[model samples]
Target: MNRTLIPLAMALILCLLAATAPAADSHPGWFGVIADPGALTIRNGVAGRLSEYTVAIGDPVRPGQIVARIDPEQAAAQLAQMQAQIDAAEAELEGKKATTNSLQERLERILTRPDALSSGALAEMRGNLRTARAETRAAEARLAQQIQERELTRGKIAKTELRSPIQGHVVEYLANVGADLSTDAAVVRLRSAQPLVLRFAFDPRDAAAPSVGTRIRVQEDRSIGAPGNDTRSHTATVESLAMIVDEDSG
Candidate 1:
């Protein structure tokens, strides 16, 4: 009985020592890092001299707002030339179609009175009708192609207007009025107003502390000229946690 009591007393002392041990350090402070870039460059899709520039630096812009315009004179002139060609093709097609109709009528009349016309003359008239029909078809196709080209020119003219792709403040003007810009040339830079995401890196030893859904406090750097020039604090939640430790940082 005395030996059993001694073992029990030693086990109770070991349990008390284990309970008094210090826990792992879990620091909630994380350095500032943006998950998404704050600025985006807006570019034009067409190449031309800028005719109109509407936005300046520090101006607020919304999505689909027209901020710049390229000169549409060249594209518009191309469309006009194509339209004239299409008109001429249509007129020529009309003439060919009228000739085809006349030949068809003559062939029908001759067919009705076969005894009045020689076989050779009827064959020549049929061939002429076929030729007129072919000419008309060719003219129609040419007019269709010209119309398609006109539509493409009009589309190019439409693309001359550069619009903002996001809601943000215009940070810089990459191109000014009368500036020649190539296709995909940047027109303006904008800084988004979306909420910033914070990234925190911690030692792998304390990784168990910042699991998903953990609450954290972030202190903002005070700006010198900002209103009240006060330091701001923001509460952020741990949305995600990286399981793997970064070799260089950890």
Candidate 2:
């Protein structure tokens, strides 16, 4: 009975030691800085001398807002030339129309007395009538072409002004006033401010568990002894996960 009791006591002591043994230590997940999840680019939409600049770096701008204006003197001069051409064509067209109307009236009068009209006189009037009609048609075509040219000139003039394409803050200014800019030249950079997002990379193993829209916490500063540094924690949604792990970091 004593031997059996000794074996039972030994087994109990072994169980206590196993239960008290410390668990293995694990490393906490390393984190990276968070930032907005979009890119910005500065571009010019028109070609002309940059006459005015209304924005600078770090200035906030709204979509469809005008950021700068180009020198409109050249464009205005072209528009004026087109307008003059249109006016001249219209005046010529009016004269041709009047001439055609007078010729038609004369033809009507002669047709009423066709029997009394001399062959030479009637033939001359008919020839003049044909010429007037032809002139009128030519004038009509010229007027149409001039009108189109005028409109095109006005459109080009409007293009001299530069407007913002998105609601964002100006991150950079690439051009200055008095600079001659060509079409598609870089002018200013825009970065979206609303619905801002933060992005950071994580271990592929941990990233697997987070799918799209998964809630996560983002820390601004990660320094030792900074207990209140995490107060600015932002809740972010997972946008995407890389399929390939970075070899160097892994």
Candidate 3:
């Protein structure tokens, strides 16, 4: 009976030591999901049949990179027509300027002529000069209008080419080559190569733990063994913490 009591006493002491020993601290902020801000869903601002697709999924993209082109046949035609109009207007303006210069030269010669008191002829010459000057000014204004119209047409022609707005990876092509697209139709999808953020939902009771500068580890799914293994998953620090409990989840 004494021997049995001694063994039981030893077991009790072992249990006490085990209970007093240091153990891993539990973190309630463990539950988290990755997030990305550079995930882009591209769309066409103009409507037309897709004429070309210059990129594919998983392709790297740069800002202002041309990713696709819509049918530009109509836009190009308008641009050409506007350009021709501008050319014609410019030619007319040059002709008007030349005529105005010639009329001014003739008026100067008439003024310098030795014949004095020719009031009637002088009045007629002055009237013809004013008419030429007015016509020249009108031609100048028309030329300016034509230039503006041509620039507008050029802008429309540029819209047919779709370009990426951000530098990132191409995730998908929503619209295929030769596919018809309406305004605001999605064209391509892209995401940044930068590291993604992890959002964790911490319990309200453990709110004090998730504070700014709190070091944390991000673990990948155990089934995949893709990250947090030999390669090791990315670790991060808490940048911010919510003070108020989420009403929707609560």
Quote each prediction's TM-score: 0.69, 0.64, 0.63
Off by over 4 Å in 3: 1-35, 45-47, 114-118, 179-185, 195-202, 206-240, 245-250
Locate the minimum summed-lDDT window of 10 residues in model 3: 4-13
In candidate 1, the residue pairs with backbone N, CA or C atoms under 3 Å apart (3 or more residues apart, or in different chains) clash, namely: none
The candidate that achieves the highest lDDT relative to the unseen native structure? 1
Which residue pairs overlap in candidate 3's backbone?
228-233
Instruction: Candidate 2: list runs displaced more than 4 Å.
Output: 1-45, 194-238, 242-250
**RMSD of model 3, in Å?**
14.5
Could you tell me which 10 consecutive residues in candidate 1 have the lowest summed lDDT?
Answer: 4-13
Residues 1-250, candidate 3, lDDT per residue (tens digit)? 1211110000011112222333335743255555666688878877788988788788899999988898988778877888888889888888888988898998898788749538898888788889989999999898888888888767766888889888897888887789888878999888866555666655544444445665555554545545553423444656655444344552
Report lDDT per candidate: 0.72, 0.66, 0.70
Better of 1 and 2 by lDDT: 1
lDDT of 1 at 244: 47
